[model samples]
Target: MDPENAASPPAGITREDLFERVWTTPINHLAEKLGMNHYQFARICEALNVPRPPAGYWQKKAVGKEAPRPELPAALPGDHARWSKGTRLLAPLPKRVYRRVERKAADRPQRPARHPMLIGVDESFRKTRTDEKNEFLRPYKYLLPDIVASADHLSTALDIANEIYNALDLKGHRVMFAPADQEMRRRHVDEQEVPRKDRKYGRYQTGSIWSPRRPTVTYVGSIPVGLVLTEMTERVTMRYLDGSYVREDSKLVRSARPWQLTHSWTTEQDLPCGRFRFVAYCPLANIEWSASWQETDAAGLKSLVPSIVARLHGSEAELQALIDAEEKAAAKRRKEWAEAQERYRRQEDRRAVEQALSHSKKQLAEIMEQWAAATAVERFFVEAEKRLEHLGEDRREHIQSRLALARAMLGEQDPLSYLADWLAPDERYQTRYPDH
Candidate 1:
């Protein structure tokens, strides 16, 4: 009988039939069968308010198990709703009650404080030299590389601040900037002063030069560059340091590489008190060593203390000797550990090989037993065929069916592979035998 006409469809041909047919058939074949282009078929489904097939659905179905059909609800009598309402109203209150309880715990007190070091970076200065007329000077036109180089110096200062911030973990700390002098402030401020219109210089008015307009400067309170550095420093410090909080006594140090601190300006004549311009004093001894920024600034006038000092002072030779001893001890321990691991690995390999051999033996025995049983049945069939040489053709077919059933009982015949041919060959026999 034709499978299509085996039974009447429960419902009329609708979107569901289209979905099943479209889903079961390959897209190219389905499109050709419907006499429509692949894209047009998809559009038709959309017009019919049906969702299009998901990408790779065909490929997935080729490898996946058939999706289970949903169970339908049983038919109910007309009076079922009334009976349900009465039964539900008479039912006892549910005993399963969920209760949540709140518990109060005592808060712990703070412990003794630990010392953490405090570090700070000074405000950076930007110097731009202008022409005699006070107009903005272009560095390339004037061959004044120093002006461009000054920007690099500011960048170095910022980098130093970042390194300090990252090393110390000062994520949320505030960085305050105080300009060295009023001249520096005027140069940095965005807004310039303008003269007021009302004032005029006169001999009758005590001969003071006055302007009507007053100088006004605009102030924008943005988070300062130094504050950003401090916040980053706090973050880094918290990440590496122990305890919930940090204190000022933790050793703080900074070092400047490639630049030396010196006096930017000096007084022409010696006097009782003379102003000195402090700069980074980087001597050869300070190279590659971490020191404080504050110390570097003060190194010109005084001998600055070393930043990274151990608890005990020792000669370079003694320190090297200690390091060598520790390294030798570590090497010896590592050698011993390696030997232990090698022995353990060898033992595991032996055990694995033994287990594999045992499993393979068991599997070979089972296979041999099955082969022997199959050979015996084939011999029996040969003997039965010899004895039934005079049997009718119908009797031969019945005997053949019995033999097929016997082979199936012995787990020899695969129905899906041999009879239905529904499953792909690779899927059916990919793992016929287990790995040894």
Candidate 2:
């Protein structure tokens, strides 16, 4: 087997055999061969009950100044005494060395102390740092459609945004895409302690005309979290200055401007691309925002993610408080609105009552006038009947007929009954306008 890619530890290498491997080569070189850093290799040696070659052991061997090999220490119960992932075994290995490694499985694998996301982000960032375009774990198209990046120049911005989203999603906050002017009743507490909503149609529009597409935004619940992506580039310019073919006429040469159209490179640059920055908006929490610049490397960028997530989590309490305040304000406004409706209804009822009262009074006056005129006519007819009785039966009969006609014309219909109905207030109206 090639020593560089040894298959595995041979079956039966013991502590003494492992020490021999270290003593044969400088500890640093041996560590490189094992693909482990010198410090890590040293720790592994301490764990494995193997004594590393002492300082200068390699130095003496290099100069042909020999020293006796140090005795290998006995394996203690806590000491790891196996050639495992970090060591190579000699060809003539004991069959039992493999058994030792198998028995020491507990010491072979050590889980990293940091989160996996942090590790992956660092690695990914490093690989793509020099890339002109952004890199994503998966194709950009697969992400939620509502996230429309500013332009192709900021294409990779979504990747960083996704990094933030994933962190929050893992923490149980559901991410939602918010359309422009969404209908959701978002309440804000005003100075008057009233809850007011600024809801509008969410469909995109320009100049009062509907637009099919609009800028994308993120939301958690009704609160909008704005995502802004900006790109900066460096630019350069060149200019040429020529004054070649001039005869050395001393007086003319002195007046000639030699610097005109000089050939040279003129370069101007804006902010460096290496310092890409992003911000996370927390609208619910006093419109709070947190921003981070991409770190110098993947590891730095990875380190930045946690703090951004922390800031977001830290604002949860404030967000809840703001929501509560808004709810209370809204409730108050609703109560006020209901009261105003009741007032308007009462005013309408009172107006109705006043109108009916005026109408009934007018109707009652007409009825009284008709009743008076009928009474006067009946009295006159009775008198005529008594006087005419002495004259003749024909005259008396005519008078009596006239009197009967008059009585029939004035039927028993009471104007007062009609007047009463017109005067009586409606119950529905009175309930709202009791005084009327």
Candidate 3:
């Protein structure tokens, strides 16, 4: 049967029809034809129990090598069963949620002098400027990988950042700046590794934390995970003196006189903690998800990299669910905006006709009132002239002069002129709509 004639299937696409289309075209390109993003389209395939071409399947097929195509499974009772472009359920097929797969940690004969993400990073993080109050590094370059630290911890921060980036590379997770073509988001990786809510905000905001123009992310298959390695903040007592803040226990504050202490006050603030933390988060703007591991007593943050990667390696299903829900909500929002625009347009069209009709009625009543007033004035003048005939010549002459002034005040009244300028409802507003 023609796919367009499929009665129960959405968008007139049957299960077999969708299966052929996915295999025939790369899923990414196929998404545009169906008016859905790649993830949304992938989800639809999953719902219909359709098997798709694996990554490199098309590449291999292009080289004339046989690429295996999996058979579509028999429909399950809960399956979406069929789909077409019009279907609301776009499939985000994260076909397999990551399972922890262990492999030999290949020892590089020599690790590259540095991972590309870390090249020139040390010089780039110079404390060219800083907030004296917190002593935070305000690097001139904000477009570095999301590694935030201080001058003293720069070397240690690089080592941990290099290790995680390279290790993920060896494990087949491509860690780097997010691809421009992908829709990705970065969580504000604060200087402190603490929960974002608990992290204190201040005038300097712990001094401008470095952020990359694009997020630093890794793709495990089609899933993109964001990474941030930052030094956590420590709470300490700060003393405000004549002009600046200094550590309460510092030499300057400790050397203060009794009189000086009387004017000074101390308050607790978050300074750069010597410790570091690694955070992994879902980088979709519509999704809120993250996991973090900071320096522990027994281990440094470097040792925690593998566990962080492993956790991301396993949380695929959870992130996929969040992404799918967001896609559906976005579609709903677009639909609502379009409906609101149409409704408003209809209301404006109807309002224009009503306003014109109301204005015409008001003008008609005004003209009739003016004509009555003009008749009254004309009769008064006529009656005064006849009464003057009965008075003496001297009295008539004086009264006639006053009547001339009154006529000037109400001069040139004509109902014909008002009628000529009058507009009917049809003339006032010529509607484009069909007549009722």
Candidate 4:
């Protein structure tokens, strides 16, 4: 909220009157007169081509170092020079949508103690870094502990992180990087007091998500707790004009009026309150556990590390219970998997045995069919020999000679050979599940 633009009028002040009032009185007081908020009044001034005083104007004026006020320019051909009392502004965001609790104030610690891990990490962080939000510096190095803070607040945030790390160290809770051999996972911890909709839920943030090559965790007894330190961001109201939302003090890229471009919007950046938040979580997969502590205006985070550590120590029993449950669940799953494998094996073996039996029966049936056919051939030869006894002597001799030729022409069939070639069920398939 701009302090120069204050309580508006019931009849809606004219462009000339609005411009004079904006420079003369604070917007907060003027807005209250019209029963309007500071944001609505500020937008009204922009819509009417009335420029409000920049931030720190009132503060400077009090000290007699105020800058010169610019003359209100005549409206462009399409610009609005007058506003009605019930002037329509863009719809506001719901109260529930962006309601963030204000974080407590933080006071810096002088010559704050440094952790062993962060001793040389400062130089490394500076070696590889990127700009964030035109204000914050994000270091890409993951060897450093996960700490998210603007360049201005980096020293303070690091001091808080360092003190906490060493305090845990002294208590025998060793704050260190996760071992390479361990297949641990780190969860993204958001410290900004931004709404869910405004936040960018990306994997790569200012060391908030997958920034750590290895998770930074501390052992509270047998339970491992993943830790992250972040400088919390306060919700700042930004005006949207010329296709971007920026601070009131920032220059516009393009001269876009409220009617020409879109309306104002809010941002999740800090008008930077130096609040810090510390988060601890379970890094193990499928285990849902986390705890957080935020600095208050009354007490700084550096002074509370000992108490926070004690709370973390107290949380051990709860974490242990979750671990025990996970172990028991894993054992049950293993047992079930083994039983399923064994059951499938038995089913396959029984199927093989049944197939073998069926195959042997088919072979026996085929052999019996061949044996019956062979018997008929033998019967025919035996009957023909008996008939030879009734023929005349010469006829019998000729017939018997012809019959011998016919018998030789038709190959002799052996009935016993069919039975000898047939196999039993055991020869067809060997069964593993003999009981079945």
Better of 1 and 2 by lDDT: 2
- lDDT by residue (78-183, candidate 3, tens digit) is 3465565555552131222334546656773543346777776677688456645455576877667888777777788888888888788777776667654346
Model 4: number of backbone collisions: 14
Q: Spell out the clash pairs found in candidate 3.
A: 42-91, 42-93, 43-91, 43-92, 43-93, 44-90, 44-91, 185-283
Rank candidates, TM-score, best first: 3, 4, 2, 1
Every model's Cα RMSD, please? 35.9, 26.6, 12.2, 29.9
- Supply candidate 4's per-residue lDDT for 210: 26
Residue 182, candidate 3: C-alpha displacement in angstroms:
6.0
Clashing residue pairs in all predictions, respectively, total 35, 14, 8, 14
How far does residue 293 in candidate 2 sit from its true spot (Å)?
Answer: 9.6
The candidate that wins on TM-score is 3
The ten-residue window of minimal lDDT in model 2 covers: 202-211
lDDT of 4 by residue, 342-404 (tens): 999999988888888888889888988898888887898899899999989999999889878
TM-score of each: 0.24, 0.39, 0.58, 0.53
Q: Which digits, one per residue and each the tens of the lDDT, describe model 1 over residues 1-436?
A: 2222222134322444545555556556656654557875564444233455567776666788445433322211111111111121111112323345455455754321211211211111232332211112223222111111123233443343333322223332222221111111111111011223332211121222111111111111211121111100111121112322222223421231223212121111111111111111111111221112222233521222122111011223443454466678778988999999977876666666666666656655666666666677778767877766677999978887887777677664222232232333333333223342
Q: Give the TM-score of candidate 4.
A: 0.53
Runs of candidate 1 exceeding 4 Å displacement: 1-313, 389-436
56: Cα error in model 2, Å: 69
Better of 3 and 4 by TM-score: 3
